[model samples]
Target: MDTGTHLVIGLGLAGLAYIDPVVAADPMVSTAVLIGTVAGSQAPDADTLLRLKGNAAYIKNHRGLSHSLPALVLWTALISGILWLVFPALPMWHITMWVFIAVAFHVFTDLFNAYGTQALRPISERWVSWNIIHIFDPVIFSSHVLAIFIWSVHLMRPEILFPILYAFLALYYIWRSWTHYRLESGLRPRDPTYEPGDRYTLIPTVHLHQWQIVKRKQDGSFQLGELRNRKINWIDRVSCAVHPAVEASKAHPNIACFLYFSSYACAELKEHAWGYEVRWADVRYRHRKQYPFVAVLLLDKKLNPIDSYVGWVSDSRLEKKLRMGGA
Candidate 1:
């Protein structure tokens, strides 16, 4: 989920904390729980600080260790401990429990989106993306906003209303998951070449019935399409052939980082007067017929990297940069 969604959800969780007798009994404890909940909700993303190092570092580590099992425990303890010192008289266990819930919820919700978290680290480092929801689902976000509004205006009891809202959201997730499963299962029969073990990446859009699907072929190419009304409309094929230039460019840190972060990466090599330019892209996300999340690397005649960039770039800006020799 996006930062704003996470923050609003955090606020909603704080409101939900009113169900606890200890939290409801004392205003001081309530305030502490509020702070702890909000902070814990945003804590795992503390890896955003790695952006100062570079996009490569940030992309590689953003949801890796920070959202792992160990990090969840650390974030809960750290946030609760800091709040404890501030409010030494409050029930420490209640604050700690809510903070832990907030942190765990943040990680859990992240698993449902395309950019998933490495929440199962040590046990497994695989990026567990359920792809059932978009990064910012208006339905989810607006529901929270509406609930917060109602809570602020004292229109309904927090404990009563929030549990109902969450229950609905839970059902919504299950419906989305069923839709995703049906779409994925249907694709195998439609495509003649689809083998049993081949990988398929489905990214959900804000619209309930729309999804972007990527089917990885055995030959390292991707079949991209959009699923509408349970039917797939083929888009384009992105080649991931093992070109020498593409292979050579992988040695660059930017390319390496892009490969690590992208689940469906495809590389294209172009020759220029100065040198070679290799463009690597994640085919999972396509907008307006463009793959915006990419890494571009320029290499001299000897295939030595001259310059490289790893991040999201607009189609126009990317073409302009490539025209200027990856400037």
Candidate 2:
């Protein structure tokens, strides 16, 4: 979810807090909890501050440690404590409780997207991406927006309205999950052509009925598809050669960082205007013929690296970057 959606959700949860009669009666406590919820909701994303240094560091740790279990406890305590200092009249326990809920909800929702979090880090560093929801979903964001609007108009009290809104949202997620499974099952290669490395993954788009699919086979062949009407329509196929990491390319910092973050990565060795280009791509995000999270290394005929890039860029920008050769 985007930052705006998360912040709106925080505000909606604050409205839901009015369910507590004590919160409804005490303006000071109500203010404190609402502030805590809004702040806590975005606290885990604090790792985005790393972008100031460069994209490599930012991509490496954006959701790695900041969204982990230990960090969850830390964010709750830190945000609650900060808010409590500013408004000392509020109950300390109340601030902590609401902040905890906001932070926990942020972590929970992130798992539904393809760019998941290492929520169980330290216990297990594995990434947990359910791939059920798009990174940005119109339905999810609009639901929260509508809740806030209704609350603003006082058409109904937030406490009553939020429960109804969230209940419907919960059911919607269940239906989407089922639909995702049906779509994936439809794409499975049921014929005798299934190879050991044959695998498929669906990437959600803005539309509920459409998805981008990437299929890989043991022979290093690739197929891209679009899912509509619960069926995959083949868009194109391309084969990429795979090789053991070339010593020079492997030694590059950008390549190391790209490999660490990519789930289904493939590298292509191609000729470039300068000499040669090594394009490392994560197929999971292959949509609209662009690979955003990629590492491009331009090398000379001797295989000596001339320049490199490790971050998101459009096809034109990537080509421009390679031509510049680290300039």
Candidate 3:
């Protein structure tokens, strides 16, 4: 989830039962306590995508442990242990109890979002990411943004209104997910040639409002289809990887960066005349390194052309250093 989006979620979860005078004064309650505690618990996942120093090992190892129950227990023990040893008089148990809850809540919310989160990692090797919501759904983001503004204005004042409003939003998603399912079920039967070993996908529904359907065909090709209001498959191939190759042929080092985030990346070269432009991202997070992008380009030493790239992140200093050093 985006940081801002997560922040709103974190605050809400932490303060859920602590808003009114009955809960506000308790060390275990209140918006301020909730925000910080939630941030700590949810903050670890951000590093899994190569944040901070941006090392691949950081990217690879971050989610494996941070989202686990053991990690939370250990975190709680350490906090309680330190507080008990240093400030024995403080309400240390409450601190530890709330800390553990905040951590668990963080992992729980991530489990429902699109980015693969390392939930149950040590105990379960499977990664988790809900395709039900877009990484940035306007409805989701706008709701959170609006909540943050309202809450910030009150400055953690004890009020029941925010919680009530948020409760309704939760129900809205339930209904939204229902519509998304209906939209998918209404689509035409998928041609199985692109599926894995003739196996069918649940026909993953992503970007709820956008209503994108990505399913594997019987032929092992991944087809990105749309079903928000209608069914449409614009790109059909073994994978989107080929599009990156086509994109590389017409890309410079800059658009190469663009390819990192383009949803429709393609690569190709011409005999001295070449062209490359993102055909899809005019509406989404353009120039943000991820979203509706089009074909990428690649060129060789003689500016001839070379292989295309796939499955890599752009703008990571650590990746840059590693590649340069490796080269």
- Each model's lDDT comes to 0.88, 0.81, 0.49
Candidate 2 lDDT by residue in tens digits, 1-327: 789888998998798778877677888888888988999899999999998988778877888899999998999989888887898777778668878989999998899889888899999978888888988889989999998998889999877998898899899999989988877876776324456767888878889988888788767767777887765577776666554334467678878777777666777777646577788877777646776778878778777778888888888777776655433
By lDDT, the best candidate is 1
What does candidate 1 score in Cα RMSD to the true structure? 1.9
TM-score of each: 0.95, 0.92, 0.61
Per-residue lDDT of 24 in model 2: 79
RMSD vs true structure, all candidates: 1.9, 2.3, 8.2
**What TM-score does model 3 achieve against the real structure?**
0.61
Could you give the candidate ranking by lDDT, starting with the highest? Answer: 1, 2, 3
For model 1, the superposed segments whose C-alpha errors exceed 4 Å read 191-199, 319-323
Per the 3 Å backbone cut-off, how many clashing residue pairs does candidate 2 have?
Answer: 0
lDDT of 3 by residue, 144-202 (tens): 66666666688654256457656877897687667656665655454433333432222
User: What lDDT tens digits, residue by residue, belong to model 1 across residues 137-248?
Assistant: 9999999999999999999998898888899899998998998888887887776556766677778988888888888877788889888876778889888656678889
Lowest summed lDDT over 10 consecutive residues: which window, candidate 2? 238-247
Distance from true position, residue 198, model 1, in Å?
Answer: 5.7
